[model samples]
Target: MPKPNEPILVALVLAAGSSRRFGSDKRLFAYNGTPLLQRSLVIPIQLGLATTVVLKPTDELFLPSLLGCYLHHPLLKVVYADDALLGMGHSLSAGIRSILQSSKSVEGALVFLADMPSLEVKTVRDIIRRFDSNKIVVPTYMATNGSLKAGHPVLFSRPWLKQLQKLSGDNGAKELLKKNPENIINVALDDKGIFLDIDHPAEVPGAKT
Candidate 1:
């Protein structure tokens, strides 16, 4: 449960991608003894937030991992995207729509990617703490050249929920972000996990069995 009177924030995990670049079902890849899809949701569950995971309708392979990690968990929900093959935006829209249909008291949703298992719990909490009803919270990191780069997972406030539902195609929310530049707040972080994702087996640290 959330603190006494804190507004509820839903954590939406998008896992419906085809993973064409990863050469196999990337969500099933193991990370620290847990499948990456399940591992990526650890912080959200730990935070006591209402969580939903978006998966492709035909993705039966992810079930074992998802059930092993969050089966019957009160705060966790699983949703499937029928149009997932169309793009990330469709999956995102499906996740958000599921939350909206299931919960009426949610203040917003913290969108996460299933392959990004390296994000720390602290980073997730910090972003949630900074989220408000009017602004979007995005994480950023410093690059090798001293330049800053944006990263995930991003928190979308309630006001944008409808617009988020309309998102489709491969661009996801990039166009929405560009159109609402004034409403976005970038939180700088010292962690590089925000930018690191396990796209291939070779890219996963300690992948050796």
Candidate 2:
């Protein structure tokens, strides 16, 4: 693990996905007065992450209106991905590319999504402490009385950048995690925050802080 004082150059937030299935923009969905995306970012921002958010404006130039959605977070850098309709993988690449363009010294990239507001900060810190610049630490959540569930907020080491760039379409790291589950250390976390994501309109209300 890098020393606590060592600076981490970037954290990529993939938020450009079109919410066609959900019938509305999920990221903009509000919960407890905060946008879903805003709640999802609380953990990474505290880790000193220079977060790069990938967003695509609608064809009618909706960026101006949506800019209001991201207002007040001066640290948030919004990069418009004109081709966001392509897929989540493209958005992932776009966020990473924006970070690289800004600073090449980024030791690693912690990829989190715009819907997972439940991810615990301490769990995130635990993952960072284990990021030795070679391995990926992904969280696994076990329900107190139910089955286990796994999800994103995965930490990818620096060496995987080229392969990450090759990602296309919506298959964002799921397949890779399967191939090297051994290389991918699973940090056990009981927090449902590890498993909760606002996939539907109603699910939005139940999402954790």
**20: Cα error in model 1, Å:** 1.0
Query: Which ten contiguous residues of candidate 2 have the minimum total lDDT?
Result: 59-68
Residue-by-residue lDDT tens digits, candidate 2, 3-53: 567746467877788788778777767777667777666776777677777
| Whole-structure CA lDDT of model 1 | 0.85
Itemize residue pairs with steric clashes in candidate 2. 118-193
- Residue 150 lDDT (model 2): 76
User: Per-residue lDDT of 5-55 in model 1, one digit per residue for the tens?
Assistant: 676788999888888999877877778778888787788888888889898
TM-scores for every candidate against the unseen true structure: 0.95, 0.84
Which parts of model 2 have CA positions greater than 4 angstroms off?
Answer: 1-9, 59-74, 143-148, 206-209
Model 2's alpha-carbon lDDT is 0.72
* Reference-based lDDT, residue 16, model 2: 81
